[model samples]
Target: MSTAEAVPKMHKACVYDQPGTCSIAIRDVPTPKPGPNEVLIKLTHSGICHSDYAIMMNTWRQLPVPTQTGQIGGHEGLGHIVKLGEGSEKLGVKIGDRVGVKWVASACLACPPCTESLEGYCFNQKVSGYYTPGTFQEYVIGPANYVTPVPESLSGEVGAPMLCAGLTTWYVSKPTVPVLGAGLGRMIYRLPELTVTAVCELLIQNMINIICVILEYSALLKCGASPGQWVVISGAGGGLGTTAVSLAARGMGYRVIGIDMPGKKQDVLDSGAEHFIDVTQFDDATIGKEVKRLTGLGAKAVIVCANSNKAYGQAVSMLRFGGSLVCVGMPEGEQVSIANAYPSSMIMAGHNIVVSAVGNRREAIDVMEMAARGVVKFPVRTVSMSELQSVFEEMSQAKVTGRVVIDFSAA
Candidate 1:
């Protein structure tokens, strides 16, 4: 193993001392050496996402198991490599290089999802701060090939949230092209003379002219709206919501309508939303009607970024004909489907409902580039390790605005 400096045997980490509650405790844990194709990172900052709070409180019902006691909890980590495992240099990562760990900590590249450029949903994925050891510590190990390189111009504090919140919301407003030749094997089986290479070349040539049409029809374009179209962002004042608002408005040219409590109005507007709706002042029916009135025929898309079940229930009603509802937030407690999605209305309106996981590695890099260019900026508040519990409490009450990042240097 290659080392940049003297390695320490122990490091400080924040752990969930009591799982299923908003409690955190700091402890000195033994640091381990990096295995083959891995590198040890000395984390400098970690963004506290609502997903982390969900894991800590055991609120997300979809998780296979409850979070164990003493588990470290954080996924959006930015740090520098301190040690490299055997053969890790082959991956072009070295000691002292800055990298970030994402929600999908590691994915087996040979998996079906990974092969299709959807590593975020890999079957063998290791989710940071879930069952896997996460980045709430001063030191953690990450796969050399999977770690995302941090741009020199992006500060660690700003880059930390981009790994999760920014990545998850960045792609909501952008268009996603469907993978070419998705079911070409079935066609080849029927016609043996057609080779894969020739078929791919023909498909590529034929697809060039219809790319714009495909964008409208592509199932992968979860938020199916073009530039200047109205897009409603529910829960648009929280960490994930604000980031989504900024990327949708400033980065992608969409007119954003942010919905949240009256307290979050300034933050939502500051994040670049053209209009803000205070949920406390309006009922679900009134909110839907207001959105329709503001957007003329209703919004072209609705992105539910809040974890509230009520937000999901009201989202479908705020869309125009052929509009999409991109679900990004994970609601706590029992799982529930979108409340207002009636089959009769959905079929007539040609509405689509899709859920988005944290983005793939390519999207992660793109979000970092967006931040580096100043096209998107996170309103961040840096806090010490001891303040983690209070942060979670505020997050649960929906009182926290923008993003809260933990500065490990303070630990």
Candidate 2:
């Protein structure tokens, strides 16, 4: 059957009434018609991400624009292309094709970042669910050139998480892993003078210097971490955390230690981590000691996927001298202030830090291909479309076990 003929009107979606809360409200919104250079997606499943919580709370400053009241709140969606608007053919999009819709809904190619193929950092970008509307609806619109094609071999539920969480995590951590050994030969390796425990002790007093300037800025700049190095992923039980584990271990071939709660140890290991650590069982000395014990050195890179301010501060404590730490998640209203001595401390420590925003089409395509080939697996729990309100409550309570995907077809 023609893909358009297969799409039905009045599909189901979850809408949020206000920030910090969400519920399922049925609305008679029209099925969006694709525009030139656009494609209409008949969505099957959409995974709720941690950032969705921020959207629900109306706290994120980087949203394409402030979300309107009763806005739809999902970006990681999987669907089939039902119709291609005029000019979409040139982009190679076709009917009946499975595709993944991610956080970045649109970016102006003329911008310096976009021209350089760094669309994730584009100053002028629109986000799904924030600016141009989102994929929570049964039928949504997407850019033909921007969407990642999903393999038929992958399930819709699995494909859903790869769109945003998988792609973002992969993109953020990819630069740290070595590829054919081309990059790091020019870089110098230096160990930090202060240990993680020392950093922890000074954390309360030197909060601004250690977390913001030294750990956040220097790690991404001076460390020059490469592939084949050890990486530690914090908060490994959650959606983005799982993606970091799989991408670092399987995709990039880095030795990864996934750290989370004790109950998540097995899940972390299943995500291709070489080792796992339950944070509750460990003291400040545990992570660095274990990391050094396992690799004869501390982590070459640390990816912070936890939303707590403490996680962000402690991530640097796990790094080796000259290693890098990447910060991805943060809690609302919690300040991340690095102390004034960061430049000198980082110079003495010889490490770097980077704060990356999550929106990269090239890296998204790379990771999605990994998902399509079954190289990376994402575990998800499905809920009927009607249960979105309860799901939000569960999320607020930290009761969610894994990625939660809403099955729109249940409508």
Candidate 3:
């Protein structure tokens, strides 16, 4: 029988409602047929990234737009193309090929952000897990041109996390550091036969942490950060925070201070942070002093990941003379602006602040190869899709220590 004929009319999907609450229901939604330029993918695995948690709990202050109710909420999916709609074949991707989707569902190419090569901020951006139906279903639909092709050597669970979490850490915010396949123009490389063991090396090169290390390297370079300079990562025990810790310490040769709750100390140490500061032990006034004492002059740069007003307040104080504060988290209902910064405070501080979200598609390719090379490894845990609710609960409680990937074989 033909692939289309064998396709099921109904597929299982995880549906959620009322974004603030983690409300989820597993139901059999009718499978959607591929539309023109779309491809039907039977997903076997998807990663449970913190972005998913942020959406589920309605934590982000700004989404590209508000999420729709009953939208299937997942993006880091790995699967095979089962059927293609009209004109999709022209994209050069074939049926039965493995592919992955990122947080961006689709963007209006005519938007100013797209015109300026910043599709991440496209004015009409449709988020995969928010505005549109995401990859939380057994069968998901994706644009043939936008879906990233999965290499043969990378497994579902292993490659799945790279789609969102890894990409966000390495690519989105860090654009200056060029890695493999960067200069090749048309970052979407022609799919190499999945025959080789060196995964990202073919179209993109290197192994895990490519994007993370390179981006950190770029950020440090941009800030005139030299080796042996002190860099503080406020959420050092969290996902992207841990990555920053690792890249700053191990990759960039920077002395790293990790600031988080007392419980995350060991996790910070494991991630290559030189020192861990227990934020709970110190009041806001004293926390910056401790960091200053530890670094002898405070950190050269402070990357804030804790989604709180206090963290942002402390981040400004945690900097040394001319130090920069980079905010990486968005806490809903919290004040993050340096609006309180008068000219005197900012002038006396001599510090700068910057914000970055996700990276370009080209960077994603570079990092995947590093992962396939088995070099940059993030701590990962596997869970069934049914456990998603519980997982989010643990995350909300600050209980999860590593990246969570869903083994959707049972989904």
Candidate 4:
């Protein structure tokens, strides 16, 4: 194994001491050696995501099982590689290189989804915080190939949230080309007189089309929105919401309307939303009407980034004809279908509903590039590892404005 610094026998980790509740305890744990094709990272900053809280409290019913006691709970981690196991150098990573671990710690690259570039949905995926040891520790191990490379110019604090929140939002906002194989085949069959050069051009286009499609499941394309079209972001003040708002507005040229509680109004607006609606001031019906009022027609897309069932219930109503509702948030407890999405009404309006999870590896790199270029920025506050429990408490009460990152350097 290649090592850059003296290895430690133990490291400090924050764990969910009591599962099914908002509680945590920091303790000294034995540091683990990286196995084959893995690298040990000395985490510097780990962002606290709402999903981490859900795992700790066992609130997400869709998960196969509840979080276990003593499980380290964090996913958005940024750090430098301290040690590399055997054959890790073949993966193009080395000790002292900065990398970020995301929600999916690792995936069986042989799985069908992984082969299709959907590593997030791999059948044999290891989630970072649920059962596997996550990033809320001084040292963690990640697959050498899967860990994202951190840009030289981006700091660990800024790069941490991009692993999850920024990546998720950027995956949907980026444009992708439609698959063109079938179209190319039909053109070739119909126009046999086409020259060899023309056919080669078509094949090249098809290849680029497939590759781009695999890279991103473009939510804006699914919403049928063009640049300058209006889009609504529900829960636009939280970590994921704010990032989505900035990427959609400043990065993609969309006219954004952010919806959140009154406490988040300024943050939402500052994140680049053209308008902000306080959820406390308007009922569901009135809020939908207000969206229509501001948009002339309704919004071209409504992205629900809040973990409220009510946000999903009101999303479809805020869309124009043939518009789309992109569901990104996972509400706690029981799962409920989107209200007001009657089959007849949906059919009459030709509205579409799309669901997006964490993005593929290519999308992650793309979003990090965007972050490095200053196309998207996250408002973050750094907290010590000991404060994880308090941060979860604040998260449960909807008190966190942007993102809270746990600094492992203090350990």
Best by TM-score: 4
The per-model lDDT (C-alpha) reads 0.86, 0.72, 0.72, 0.86
TM-score of each candidate structure, all chains considered together: 0.89, 0.82, 0.81, 0.89
User: Which residue ranges in model 2 land beyond 4 Å of their true spot?
Assistant: 1-3, 6-9, 61-66, 175-227, 283-290, 338-341
Q: Against the correct fold, how does model 3 do in TM-score?
A: 0.81
Error of 2 at 310 (Å): 0.6
Model 4's TM-score against the true structure: 0.89
- Candidate 3 C-alpha lDDT tens digits along 1-411: 124436898988887866778777888999998999999888888887667878877667665455567878998888888999999999877788888887886666687877765667778767788878888878888888778777768867768877766666554223354432233212234346444544445435432335555545342354335567888888777766766666556544568899887877887898788789988899877988899889888888788776667788888777888887776666765345653445688788787876666555565675566557554445667878788889888878877765677777863
lDDT digits (tens) for residues 172-224 of candidate 4? 66665431213443444546787878877776767766566567665235446
How many residue pairs clash (N, CA or C atoms closer than 3 angstroms) in each of the candidate models, in the order given? 0, 19, 12, 0
CA displacement after TM-score superposition, residue 111 of candidate 3 (Å): 2.7
* Model 4 lDDT on a 0 to 1 scale: 0.86
lDDT (10s digit) by residue, model 1, range 107-159? 99898989877888899999999888898889999999999998978987889
The TM-score that candidate 2 achieves is 0.82
